[model samples]
Target: MTGWLGNRVITQIGILVHDIEQVSGAYAEFFGVDKPPIAETDSPDMAKTRYRGQETAARAKLAFFDMGPLQLELIQPDSEPSTWREYLDRHGEGPHHIAFVIEGMEEKVMLLEGRGFPLQQRGEYEGGRYAYMDTLKDLKVIIELLENDKR
Candidate 1:
């Protein structure tokens, strides 16, 4: 996998929260760290995502905070039935999924899907695209593919 995806794994962490501000504040209070700057973005092209043969909005408020070598992302969805909203609604506030920074995310998703790894959800943010691959049969965890942010 490393050979195929040249970039080193920069971050791997599960982001959990009911509210983006609350979660980000908890990290700051617990780690005695200041919140990193945030960036706001909205693109109609990105909002029109194909999910289950239907177009859906992907509007969100995302902020990245530095925690040692790992970065914690706080995501607040602006649409119904979003991954974040689903997690919060179903499980309350908790670890959503572990993300793996990688290259060629689309290709990686295809390979994983072909290998019987069921994709629970997939979408794009301001920074990059990501997919949640169910690998419970092997490791009992969902693997996330986060492509590097080119913008």
Candidate 2:
């Protein structure tokens, strides 16, 4: 399929929660798997995080579960101005975004921006980068783009 994104395959689903440990524990029980470790996001220097078009020190505690063809991500944001925090504040705990593993993340983001869905938040991890697009008003949910560095 073809769209604004470089890739069309959805690789993950993200959920926002107030207490990750509690929610992740429940998911672990339901899946009959060990609870994934909760980890903090990269610092602003390392991640180069941006929120609302400006540099910000926003981060979240995250846990991930690989559920067959898709990964389930649970997020508990700090008191920072991150996308996670913003969504949780306005919408409460629930599905936050669906993610696509993509290539040419910057180019894809540019294309989306040209179409009016501007980038809301972005950050870099160890081997990949992620961007949250402001698509909720149009798509009913935010779209997250994940681009792994080519090895």
Candidate 3:
């Protein structure tokens, strides 16, 4: 059967972690690079976060490592109810999501929803939109779709 995500490259791999600092250090060591910069959801662009389709006060501490064309994202959910927190509660610290960049994200989301993948969390930033699909049962990892507005 075909998947709703269509033909696209997996651009990111997100890992849910308990400690961003420690995980960043470990990843930096593994990648033979200095510590990756950590970014929070406090930016004006990402002023709001959502969980399960509802606007939420949840926040996450994030660090990103650049690996050529792909990115490795480390996410630590602060004491809030969110997809990352839920993943941590259910599976502990481990691989969480694989991301794809797509155009017409809302339409893609609807298509995926029709294929049994429901939106678990979604948010927006100034330049892009991101949504996590609950695809763990089928793919063993949540699927994240990112769409950047072409400027």
Better of 1 and 3 by TM-score: 3
The C-alpha TM-scores of every prediction are 0.73, 0.96, 0.92
Cα lDDT tens digits, model 1, 49-147, are 444334556456667876678767776665555556666676666666667788788788778878887676676666777777766577665567788
Q: What's every prediction's RMSD, in angstroms?
A: 3.3, 0.9, 2.1
Q: lDDT of each structure?
A: 0.65, 0.93, 0.86
The CA lDDT at 62 in model 2 is: 94
Ten contiguous residues minimizing lDDT sum, candidate 3: 41-50
lDDT (tens digit, per residue) of candidate 3 on 1-151:
3256664688999999999999999989988999988888764346566788677878788999989999999999887788998889989998999999887888998988988989898887768888999988888889999888899
Model 2 scores a TM of: 0.96
Least accurate 10 contiguous residues by lDDT in model 2: 1-10
Q: Work out how many backbone clashes candidate 2 has.
A: 0
Q: TM-score of the candidate numbered 3? A: 0.92
lDDT of 2 by residue, 62-141 (tens): 99999999999999999978899889999999999999998898898998899999899999999999999999889999
**Model 1 root-mean-square deviation:** 3.3
Residue 75 in candidate 2, Cα distance off native in Å: 0.2
lDDT of 1 at 151: 54
* Candidate 1 regions with alpha-carbon error over 4 angstroms: 1-10, 37-44, 136-138, 149-151
